[model samples]
Target chain A: MNQTIETMLNHRSVRKFKEENLSPEQIQMIVEAAQMASTSSFIQAYSIIGVTDPEKKKKLAKLAGGQDYVSESGHFFVFCADLYRHSLIGKWENADVDDSIMSMEKFMVSVIDASLAAQNAAVAAESMGLGICYIGGLRNNLPEVSELLETPEHVIPLFGLTVGVPDQKTAVKPRMPFQSIYHENSYRHQKDTVKQEMNEYNEAISAYYHERTAGKRSDKWTEQMAKMLQRKSRMYMKEFVEGKNFAKK
Target chain B: MNQTIETMLNHRSVRKFKEENLSPEQIQMIVEAAQMASTSSFIQAYSIIGVTDPEKKKKLAKLAGGQDYVSESGHFFVFCADLYRHSLIGKWENADVDDSIMSMEKFMVSVIDASLAAQNAAVAAESMGLGICYIGGLRNNLPEVSELLETPEHVIPLFGLTVGVPDQKTAVKPRMPFQSIYHENSYRHQKDTVKQEMNEYNEAISAYYHERTAGKRSDKWTEQMAKMLQRKSRMYMKEFVEGKNFAKK
Candidate 1:
């Protein structure tokens, strides 16, 4: 009975999916599971969009870094960092919610809420024999994703997920050492010894990548990260936040 | 077997804990489960600290917005949005990490990683007949919490959680309508209609609060939020982030 929790603990990104569809009942179960997650201040500041349309999925696939799995998966969902719900509450209360409360802090709350709920949904789907992969590449063309989705003001696409039966098996990605992340009481800057720990993890990650890509990229974790840093992400995000009149002031 | 997933689907906050101690093995199981959550790029940008010392718990209780559960729970853990680990990795790689990577995006990543891991811990703890209460109030005094924990640069306390065997029961909190939080394929602004749906939820929440708090406060969700927002939270968080050299341009 408790084994599911352990399964949740051992989650890994599944990039391959079999050709089968998730039943509507299963989709409803996952959505309800997600809805049950904690919302900040009872302000449910997030939303999920499920995509079962094949044509739409193909378009989204192109938008999200050309990943075919997104289009091929049994289900696709986009999590939104939302404030329009709160905006409605503001109008009901006849209160003026300025940029202050709606700023980055609020956006953060929405993002955290959405992300947590998404994780829960992921856990549930995995428990039900579904393989899942998060499509962070949705950020690469944020405006387009927003446009395609018909997202309104005070909402932004945080990420996408593809869920289906597993078509391929993958090794668990190695993580940085516990000492690197687990701090005692407060943060210590000098815990720089984590670098040594990650050195080992880097080798592990490198080998895994080599086997996965057949040596198309020998880049280790550090190298990939360095390359990723050069690319601009959500370049107009701050402006978009302001333009949508979401709180960043 | 399917009911186990329903059990996870039935999660709610647990505030009161029986006066019993948790075994170290049980604690380890939960914390290890938390540690296994996915970290962005394997950076593992978070930390959790267990606090079992009673006097220390009492002090933290005062710091955590006077939440008595802080001291009453069988176990307490402080989840931190930490980057000190990555800083160490940078040192080992002898790589200069630009401060820009520590922007709002990265900060959100750290916070989300910690939050998701905490949620997993919460779920795991619940599976084993444990009760839990998330302590967002920990952010009521971020610097003080950080100071008390000896958290160094590049790390910040995100929240705290108290887990134990249940001594008191808390009702399942009401959620917004499915349509309100779940969209089709993009963000939608349905302020007027969502507000109407929220009016019913406000009533339900009001009823829930009245029962829990003995009708000491009004039951309207909007009113409660208004009252809560009247107070300041994280007033200095931006400055704090800047002081930590996180928002450095």
Candidate 2:
């Protein structure tokens, strides 16, 4: 197999880390690698806040669904979809960059750009024999995170990533069948086959959960999702984001 | 430096790729790596269409703003933000994921999930000594791409990635100063020194462009962006995306 395929197939989330700080040079290298990613129209609408302070990490951990790994991790970075720089450029050019450009498409573009860059950094760390985990809980409190980062208009935190030296190894997570997600030529909205695949995936995930959770049968992916969706987790962040002057429409 | 970071830092678009066909196992590995990315609420709102057919690649190249690389690349995959899967799920459960669930927050989550996955696959390719380029031009004809891909409703083509062995080597692209994009707290917009950095970057890019374009001046990042933005790219894509059954209102 090609090296890329090998590395990708072997991916596993590393939550525990050795207690060691990353060198400044290493940080620069990783960030530079992230900067090399493709940006929409070269606007590069994203930013990464390298959080080094422990107290801040503690608070961040609390905000992010109480994930202790976030606070204890060696390097924590919050990636953001930032158009503030472009807005400043707009001010210089005296153009209205606020309204039309702040649509769903633009928002999605910036968020995706940031995530792509973060993933590159994650893979880079892993290739260096380091560990990484994506902290999606960062979105639990958008305004709080924005305030913590002192982010200005048109910039919102999308997610956080924790990187460090590995303290433990884990199994790579299994995914649903490709046919369930991949469509040929057009989308097929059938659920029987997908449901069957989900059931199998659920069993596999449940076994993994049991191995990790000390013989407890965890909720299936679907059940967990239904609960979270019904509970409307992080729903309040929507207004906070819009209130922060992003998503102008 | 770790191999992954080196790969990312050295990333340059490969417009030219060697003529080699990827094995089905390699393709599966890339897709699996993509699926492993963290999805918001575990909804997995993304899809990928791998295009290997020469005729389809040519048509895709033509549709994607005449980018010859699309046809020339050995492997091409279209990454999409797919809400259609969830729509089907909602139908099965006799429930609606609805407008509230499809908020900007949800949209951002799906886009990031898809992008992060794609980036992982890209890095995997790079680590394996392969070359890849992200094709943002895929958005140039969203409807056509959807039609060509047989994309169903609620799925939007976020971007395309072309991958293979490198047919030619390219110099690394220069980036804006770290300070310009990276902010301390909140955002400190409009700096006196940023202008100088911008000028430097412009000079660097212009030199690169000149070399690439046979002594012609390549406009600075901002200048190039201004020109691109003036074209009102993706102006009508908003309506088209929403029309495809994605809820915007």
Candidate 3:
């Protein structure tokens, strides 16, 4: 395999980081890589906010549920699904585009755009021998995070990427089996087939957790997923996205 | 720059492709790379469907608005945001996870997961000297596409990826100015500042279209965006996604 595939195959989220900052050149390279990702309809409905200020990083760390890595990474970037520029374009052309921009399709487009870009940035960082972690914890308080970042309407912060030199290395977490996630020609929607595949995956994951934690924790994938899902986390996301004037339709 | 960054920066969607099918090994490698992408909380809420049957590809090409590449590519993969496995897990564990699964937060997670994995697969294919294009046109008729794929509830087809050997090379389309998309710490929300930046971009894009088409077409970015957004598209996406038992909360 080539270096690119090798880099991807060895991917892992790095939470701990060395006390060092990325050079301006590195950050620019990462952002440039993100820019090259494909955009739906060439809308490029996304933006990257580089958090360099110490105070801002500290605040974001707390806002992200007290994740110290959010403050300690070499550089933290917030990826935003932004349609503000489209709104401006509509205003300049005197076109009523609000109905289109507020539609669920556009919202999905923006989210997909931001996500594809973020993944490219992650790969770019990893290729440069750096470690990266995606901090979904930013969603814990998006309104405050948006206020702190001074984001405008039609710009929703989706997630944060923390890139830095590695302070620790961890094993790549095994994913669900290929049969479970890959279908040929059409979906294998039979429940019994899926259950058998998932049960096998559950055993593998339980073994992984057991080995990692030295028997302290060995939860099956189903048990962990059920527990997490039963809690009903992030119930405010719909209202919050609507508040930002997105997906209102 | 390294080969990985070089691969990303040189990305251009290929519509015209040489008529050659990819080997099974290539497909496996690409999907493996996709699985290596980080998932939100390890949810892995996505699946890839390899469309190989000629009849299926022909129907998909029609479903994707007569995009020839959808049928002509070396291989086409449909990336889907899936929670079917999780729903099954909940059923097995006797846990009430429907509230969480139906939340907007989980919906976003699934979409992001699918997008990230698709991007990784795209990069892997490109690194192997294959051309790749994302077909958002799959959303044109989601119900029919889902029915064709036989996807179960909680599984939404996000988009399709067509990979092949390039028959024609195209220059990379210019993106917005770096300053326009990248902000420092906080978003630069001033309308005038953004307007000025976008105006400069408009000139660049207009010139690009002019030169590329030898003056046959010269549309400014704003004009194109306004025209496209003026027409309401994909009004059925919300109802379709909700019908799939997602984002209903």
TM-score of chain B of each: 0.91, 0.91, 0.99
Q: lDDT by residue for model 1 over A138-168, one digit each (tens)?
A: 8667778888888887777877878999898
Q: How far is candidate 1 from the true structure (C-alpha RMSD, Å)?
A: 2.9
User: Residue-wise lDDT of candidate 2 within B1-249, one digit each (tens)?
Assistant: 655566677888788987786677767767777887666556777888888778888998998889898888768998888776566555555555666356656666667878987887787777667788888888778888887777766778888999888999888877777766555434554555555666777788888888888887777776765454444456665577557754354
Candidate 2 colliding pairs:
A4-B124, A4-B128, A149-B186, A150-B186, A151-B186, A185-B149, A185-B150, A186-B150
What's the lDDT for residue A238 in model 1? 52
Residue B68 in candidate 3 has what lDDT?
92
Q: Per-prediction RMSD in angstroms?
A: 2.9, 2.8, 0.9
Error of 3 at B41 (Å): 0.4
DockQ for each numbered candidate: 0.47, 0.46, 0.90
Question: Which runs in model 1 stand beyond 4 Å of their true positions?
Answer: A199-235, B1-4, B206-218, B230-232, B247-249
Best-to-worst ranking by DockQ: 3, 1, 2
Candidate 2: regions farther than 4 A off? A1-7, A93-100, A210-214, A244-249, B53-55, B90-96, B184-186, B244-249
On residues A101-175, what C-alpha lDDT tens digit does candidate 3 reach at each position? 998999999999999999999999999999999999999899999999999999999999999999997988998
lDDT of 2 at B106: 68
